[model samples]
Target: MIRLGYPVVGVADLTVAAAFWTAALDLAESPEWARDSWRTLVRQTDGERVLGLMLSDSAPEQYPRIHLDLLVDTTAEQETEVERLIGLGAQRVDWDSYPPDPDFVVLADPDGNVFCVVDLSRAPSGS
Candidate 1:
């Protein structure tokens, strides 16, 4: 099987993006990188993998089509997080759920990268 790695995000300012993710995901920033341009973050509950965010000197001209879908414990908290992100320049493109879906919300990051806030209540525990 091919190894699919965690996505590394490119941001204008890693510090700002880091703060947004920390507050939104309740993740702790890792001090592995010596420079502010590169930073690591891991969730407190599961430290299996880390998400990397790097500072980009030039912004992406095209809309970022790919994004991370965060499985959330609570939709309410996720909503709050979404609001916080929107406050920090993240855009609200859409919020949608089909009949089969339990719960979820869609949002775009500051750079137009679209992602989903998914409710994990339906997932098998311990996954």
Candidate 2:
């Protein structure tokens, strides 16, 4: 049987990206996986590895084929979290392809990597 591994994100500056991600997601850096060009982040309370950041020189795509989607239980929480993330250096993206009643907001990390903050209470129909 095969198992799925955690997602790895490419970032131009690993230290800055690590700082933003660790604070934004309540994760902690994993020293065991530390390297000059890469860093692994784990859950703060459980030490379960959740994400990895790899050094990359290429620019982030305007429309990435894959991106992270963070979930919040309520619209209020989603709004609050989006603000909080912005306080931590995230920027709101002016997405052009939103549906009539979208359930997620687009945000870009400091490195310009785009992701979404989804409100589960308003998730798209049939999703």
Which candidate should be chosen as best, given lDDT against the real structure?
Answer: 2
Which pairs of residues clash in candidate 2, taking residues 3 or more apart in a chain or in different chains? Answer: none
Q: Give per-candidate clash totals.
A: 0, 0
Off by over 4 Å in 1: 1-4, 45-48, 57-65, 73-81, 84-89, 94-103, 120-127
The stretch of ten residues in a row with the least summed lDDT in candidate 1 is: 94-103
Candidate 1 lands at a TM-score of: 0.64
Clashing pairs for model 1 are: none
lDDT at 21, model 2: 99
Q: Residues 84-111, candidate 1, lDDT per residue (tens digit)?
A: 7688767776443444654666676665
lDDT of each: 0.70, 0.96
